[model samples]
Target: MGVMNELINRENVGMLAKILAEAAPGSHWPHVVAAASELDLLSLRARTDAVSRALLADLRLLPDPGYPTAARAFRSALTAAGFTGWILWPVSEAAVTLALEAGSGADPGKDFDDCLALLAELTPRLTGEFAVRRLLAADLERSLQAIQGWTVHPDEHVRRLASEGTRPYLPWAVRVPGIVLAPEATIPLLDALYRDPSDYVRRSAANHLNDVARHAPALVVATAQRWLSAPDSNTAPVVRHGLRTLIKNAHPGALALLGFVPASIAVNGPRLDRDSLALPGELAFDFEISNTGPADARLAVDYVVHYVKANGTRSAKVFKIGALTLAAGETRSVTKRHAFRQMTTRVHHAGVHALELQINGIRHGHTEFQVRV
Candidate 1:
């Protein structure tokens, strides 16, 4: 389709008719132009399935030292195509430059890490493993060098790309674990990004750490606590976000850090036996609290579940009940409904999966039951 595929600049989109008038048979201009309108004229990635695959093929054609319009077009194409698009990664570092130019947040598809893959080819990470591993570790070193130097470029977009670009899992690009399983490996890069001054860059640093936390809780917790303790204005948000999961999970340390406690618990209905009772389908709970102090109190009660995920990893999650005011000697009942339809899916292979009730985010009551799916 000649280069009609590459007219992706917001300014050039105005010239779409002239470009589309010359589309060869099977050309992707009409679709790319049409889709580009739906996505911000300068949107980050391909939006629809057909458009993604079409752009995927077109993106492979351009080499590095990309033309602006072509580079932008290639970004959408690769972004939409996702992991499948990055099959061309080793051969073209050009896409990385284009991605760097875009400087947006995460890509849209399941294969977002494809460009990150190119960085792996450019650097040596101790844990360079990724969803679809095809590159040699040696090739990644050179690419990493180029990426580091590009950090100093004047374009905020490009600078954002430097940090947002390296996430092990950039969601939609590709799912990799350069930093998730191995935090130490990504530390140097994170240090560079933490003080970046750009909220965009700082946010990226935060998200990357948050992603790492899901798989490696301890690393994220430690990192978050360290950041909270250190006196750096830029890192606070990143650290707070990183610790959010842990806080929700009722991590002992996190509860202690925030000085959170289960002040009062009021449960309605039958008190559950922790050893032999399992919530089936729909279960209900009611809570009431009495403010024992002189001043008004703000509080919350969470329903904590020891979930056995489809993959069998047991974890806890908290759902908020909002803030409440309880003047002294005032007790108000809070109603809650705990749905157990999903628990049926966790038909365990034995052992106990605990369900807990918390007041002000701390565990106060619990019930357990057997499930075999």
Candidate 2:
């Protein structure tokens, strides 16, 4: 089986940027941008680095060739350039700062609306997050109103910003102090985009609400129930995704909702290695589940493989598997696939390893095993 190689060295990113730049100067930015995303997982921590920050600053100064599709390239470039502190620093703060400073307080009505309009136009291409931060830093009411106004815009992109801009722990974006301050106000914005026609916009709403749910479980649950109560085609999926974290790890209410029951799911069993069937090998596993429900569900499975490393350090790798659908009264059998496979660099040593089954992103059951090779 072919393994997906992890980005350890930045050979691809560095080389691709140069190649693209030489082949197509106008589109080189995107190449660099994609390279950055490709390398994001390899970084030791979840923040951008200093060199990446410098790149963003430079990219911001370069003039665009004025292409439309190339327009998104700007935001992607900004994201790529952050390199570090992308999520750590407040991005929206800087944008709103620029917006406010560019405005004249003397004319605050139509002029303010026009000013916001300009900001909205540039929003997809600019930064947002620290938007709440910037709002609090300057004029709170005005900033909130602007974001609220953005929620109703004809553009799906604007509506998306209304939610994404407010997400807590938004990656590479700064946290908004305002969200922590006037948390209730954030609800209206979430509500506006809750049933947005665009699935893209809806996902943003789900993520934002999920972030809020961490802090206000009751409020989030209430909002979720309000939507789930009716099972409106639109809101159901939104509610499910929004409540993912709560559902996962089996929060009491969520567990009850899912009708979870504890049973002796795990059974010690042995199997012959289809490959050799020569030496005595030990592997532990367990299971049984079928939706037999009304809807086609996307289930998430979680597992952590524990094995002794060649360096003698005990280690583990957690992974996801099998997002499939089973109709009502349907029988779907899921075959177990190893997340972390036999590696040339790592040897299997006798020790303990753990695995868990997650339904809809929630961990409903778990088991452990001893493997020796």
Candidate 3:
């Protein structure tokens, strides 16, 4: 089973139940386990969602387990279970689910504050991103106000969530169309977090900025340039990671901002061990790079494999091989093997395909191969 499938298995469920039972002995957890166990684990989403719902229902069984208070009770349970400094624990989904459940049933006038408090408590453990998105959907102005407050929170995790939760393209969560439409709104939060003392917070800020760059490339490039102008240790990496998508796409503005100028180099003797391979086989290829420039050349060596689709269209996937500063008159030889093993995401198709070597976003050489299934 994959990592997600294994995360909430029998053993994990028992641990979670024990933790809950210990934290709030009066709150029945045995029934929670029973309900959650019936969920189908055929896929990660189905299992997580089903269990999240089951957990929320089981919490409702408690005698007047109040909002925000119950969320705090769960947080206490996590800490008692020795999960105090951990982020994204196995039981995180349960906390997030409970937050969403409470928020969904909240009375806008009386329960709003309590719901936000619950989300604040849950954000550090698993994530409040999904739960916050629901609030944003209901009231963008109010939800954003709450998120803005978290930007300066004493807890780095809460500050990180301020940026991460509002991301337009947060992976594994539903996309937020509003953010894409107005990527500008998230800028202030990211700016507040760009120089966060915590690497964890900084990484989230970078990723959040990268999501904005997807919709507003020029804006993000400008933002990165400004951030890099006063480069600190934290901001430098944040800028690099934030501009990663733009760099990968070979956006000229991003390339110029990063100073990954085109270099003078020559690719020689592109050779494949075999021109064809069957399913479950691997393809090995070799190539040589010679620096022809008079000065040292900083190079980002990467390869792209153009895979044939079922309809005869081709999709290219880029993989980074190495990054180095090659001295003048230097030559380096590289060998790489690509596996055609079956995966849940990719299906092998028998056809001729193309491979290209790219140096600092410049294609250096091209070759072809065939795959037979």
Candidate 4:
């Protein structure tokens, strides 16, 4: 895949300028274009901020310039100019910057509320998730109160944003300290959305809860329990995804909630096909599990790879091997292959690595292997 920074490059930046020029006639499109032209070596976020600053300067020069004026221009761009996609990133950012600036005025509350609405509108074009962080940080209660109403919004995108935008650890988005301080703050939003009819919205709600689980596992388990109690057709998957982190850590509450309880069982070798492999190779293994108890046992089988880090320490990463049910005294065997390909997200070091099996939140069957660069 192409680097994410390339998404907001000079070409798309010029397109954004052209669209903004159409939306608001006589604006300095050239200035925005020039700003992007000079951005040769900026990261994705830095490029977005630089372009936003350039757009904000132009927005300020509009007739009777202010947040309202900028909002109107953006609306016109969406409706009249038909602008959309990655190009809208800087547009949304500029609008938010203007809105936050407007928050220092006579009615900061109204400005905050208005900005939230603008974000809802802009979300359908391009996510306002990153932009809304500033507003949430600026006024947590007010912004959340406004977002609470969005759970019932007719549009799925807006409903998704209601949960996605408020996530405590939303990737590629700024941190909202208030969210971390009050972990339970966004629970109400997730509660309203976890059973949403739209998979799109429910997915966001699931991810939001997962983010919460990062800091407060109990809170997530509790929330998930409540969701399971009054579940709809899609609630099970939502809860599973939401509790994924907790499940990986083998949290008892999370495992039990998904019916992956402790059971009398026996595990055999995660027997390796080979003990050593080179880069771009695969490690194949198999394991057998027998339900030793009289009762049937449901299992959530997963594997952990203890990778050799650059500093010679090992870091464990979990990978899932689908779930299954074992009848009374039943035994099942499974085989899996894991690739050791170099990825941008992970570096391969020449050292001893290990693999282990996890079943129903329990670890079993350890095996070590050597990797060569």
Identify the leading candidate in terms of TM-score: 4
Error of 2 at 244 (Å): 1.1
Per-residue lDDT over 32-81 for candidate 4, one digit per residue giving the tens place of the 0 to 100 score: 88887876788878888888888877777777788888887788788644
**Candidate 4: residue 129 lDDT (0-100):** 89
Q: How accurate is candidate 1 locally (lDDT)?
A: 0.49
Tens-digit per-residue lDDT, 254-280, candidate 1:
555544544543444224423343445
Return the TM-score for each candidate structure.
0.49, 0.54, 0.81, 0.95
**Candidate 2 overall lDDT versus native:** 0.52
Candidate of highest lDDT = 4
Residue-by-residue lDDT tens digits, candidate 3, 64-112: 7545556666667756544332222324455544444454443633355
What's the lDDT for candidate 4? 0.88
TM-score ranking of the models: 4, 3, 2, 1
Better of 2 and 4 by lDDT: 4
Give the alpha-carbon lDDT of every model: 0.49, 0.52, 0.73, 0.88
Please give the range of 10 consecutive residues that has the lowest summed lDDT in model 4: 79-88
> What is candidate 2's lDDT per residue for 1-373, written digit by digit as tens?
1122222224444543443344334643443444455544444222224223323443444474212222243233444433222231212232333445444456644433443454456455443443444443455566677888878888877788777866765774556666766667678887778888899889999998788877777777777777666655788779767876666544655434433333222222212123221114433344545655455544444444545556656675544443444454554445454533455565465445555555554454545555545
- Residue pairs whose backbone atoms clash in candidate 4: none
Better of 1 and 2 by lDDT: 2
